[model samples]
Target: MDTLTHTQFTEAGLADWRDLAQGIHARFATGDFATGLRFVTAVGQAAEEAGHHPDVTLTYPHVDIMLVSHDAGGLTPRDLDLAGQISDIARDSGVSAAVEALVEVELSLDTADGQTIGPFWAALLTGSTDSFADGQVRDSGGRVPLLWFQDTDAHETPRQRFHLDVWVPTELAEQRIAAGVAAGGTVVDDSAAPSFVVLADAEGNRACVCTTDR
Candidate 1:
């Protein structure tokens, strides 16, 4: 499956789901454990039928779902189709959609020599460098936040070289940014608002609030 661009996905209008950096996420309020299990069962059946499955997380009264095409490295039409089907299942089960409940966080390392540092991070994070060949480090088990290097020219001055890349639903970007500001965080840059906004805490360390709305 080929990767879908942000515009293509946004144009598709997946109202029932939210696109995050890691995947498409949606939460269904199942009301109880049994109800949630039933919903998961239905989702499993739908996934089996479609030959694709989502990563599901069950909390009491809530079932969170995430879908991404790992091979394609992003969202595809298959994800959209499955999201639609899952929406149908949610409707049939009398579940409510909770779009605000999902977010994805990734770690980013700024380095001029990722090829050299990549191995160390992969080994420290995942115990192997197999995921380091392409200058991005990921755990094969998907158990850790992805660490990708941001290319930067060597600087003479020392600065914070690590930060978080927080990915959230498009609709929630502003709200999240505002919340961060209210929490004593400052928006250092919104030149790329909605797509990405750089924020810094009171101490001046930077992180980004990101969305796929672009």
Candidate 2:
């Protein structure tokens, strides 16, 4: 299946879900464990019927859902269809989408040689090298943040080489960056602004606040 571009996915009208990072994320309020399980069951049946599955999490009062075509390396029409079905199930189950529950984390490692270090990070993080590809590594279980190498020339100066790339809903990027600043973090760079803003802590450790608002 071919991957759907961000614009195409947006045009499909998935108001109940948020496109973040590589997946479409949604959280439904289930009210209780049993209700959450029931909702999950319904979603499972829907996914089974569609021949596509979503990454689902049931936590007491909420069920977080993420849909992506891992094989396609991005979202596809199948994901959009399943998302619509899932939205219907949520409505029938009386669960509402929780936008605040959506966020995606990715790890960036500055390296001069991605091929040389990719395998080590892949094995260390995922217990296998099967997820290593295109200078990035992802766990088979999809539970951990992806690790991607950022190529840079070797330098003798000591500095932080690893940083977090946090992708959140576009509307929330500014609020998040403000919260980080309020928490004593400084804005390192905002040339990219809403798309991506680099922030640094007191110790100079950097993390980027990223959005898919492009």
Candidate 3:
């Protein structure tokens, strides 16, 4: 299966889901443990029937689901179909989809030598260096946020090296940015508006508000 582009996925009319990072994600408010369990059970059965499984996390108040085609390295038609089915299931179960609560976070490091440092970070974060690929460290179990390297020229010691890449729905990017700014963070850069906006805290540490709109 070929991977679906962000534009294609957005055009698919999956109102309950958002494409973030490498997958499509959705969160449903189950409101209780039993309801969440039942919802998860139904989702499991549906996934089994479709032969495509989504990573599901059930908490006391909500269930989070993420679907991606690992073989294709991104979203595929199977994901879209499963997402639609899952949405229907949520409706039938009387669970409300909390689209606004869905978000993905990634860690990024500015590095002059990712090839040399990737293995160390990968081993430390995931207990295996095998996750290191294309200047990024990915936890196959999804236990940790994706960590990618940003190539940069070597600089002096004591400079900031790590920052967060927060992925949110495109429509929420500006709102999130505004909230951050209102909370004392400053917009350091917006030259890449709609795709990413760099923001810095009062103390100068930087992070990015990112979206898949690009």
Candidate 4:
């Protein structure tokens, strides 16, 4: 590939905000050239199946590899999932190297309006009136950064950027969507497991609630 310039980097930045994620990298070495070629072939098969092609370079008995799921935008559960599988493949081939690559993403969105809006979610999730301090509520799980609710003057031509994908073993998609609707969120779409219902807050900002099991 050609060298990327600063201008090119700036112009090619992510429009969806998910492109800032990091990928995975693995290094492999073998005593013989044939073993290296075999390793490359095995990696190719895995990449094709996962739909994630890894970067690879080989010189006789040494190969360097890097992996990132560019389609997912940022490092996500999926990226790590693929990384682990790749590690297992390397181990099976008698090639050993530290898997030194992982994607880390940090985000902070402070919307003046979101602060006021958070009370609604706090109430919905907790099943009680919001007792948020200064209109801020927090939800935490794993390495996920804080999802904030800020307070803004006005939103023009509202649209949903982030949504939730709630999973349940059974197809309770409609019922769950109703619960959100009952809690003051508008159900924007319920068309199509791997399905989602787009939603909007009382102020018309968008989010989605979906379940893969459905």
Tell me, by lDDT, which candidate is best.
Answer: 3
- Return the top candidate by TM-score: 3
Residues 71-170 of candidate 1: C-alpha lDDT, one tens digit per residue:
7888889999999999999999999998887788999988899999999999999998787867789786878988999999987657899999999888
User: lDDT tens digits, residues 87-170, model 2?
Assistant: 998999888888876788999999888999899889889888888998899786877788999999987658788999999988
* Lowest lDDT block of 10, candidate 4: 13-22
Ranking by TM-score: 3, 2, 1, 4
After TM-score superposition, the amount by which residue 145's alpha carbon in candidate 2 deviates from its true location, in angstroms, is 1.7
Give the Cα-based TM-score of candidate 3 against the true structure: 0.98
Question: For candidate 4, what is the total of clashing residue pairs?
Answer: 16
Estimate the TM-score of every prediction: 0.93, 0.95, 0.98, 0.35
User: Each candidate: RMSD to true structure?
Assistant: 1.6, 1.3, 0.8, 15.5
CA-lDDT, candidates in order = 0.89, 0.90, 0.94, 0.51
Clashing pairs in 2: none
For model 3, how does the per-residue alpha-carbon lDDT over 1-214 read when each residue is reduced to its tens digit?
A: 7889999998999999999876999999999999999999999999999999999999999999999998888899999999999999999999999988878999999999999999999999999999999889999888999999999999997889999999999999999999999999999999999999999999999999999998
Ranking by lDDT: 3, 2, 1, 4
Model 2 residue 154 distance off true place after TM-score fit, in angstroms: 1.2
Can you give the lDDT of residue 193 in candidate 4? 29
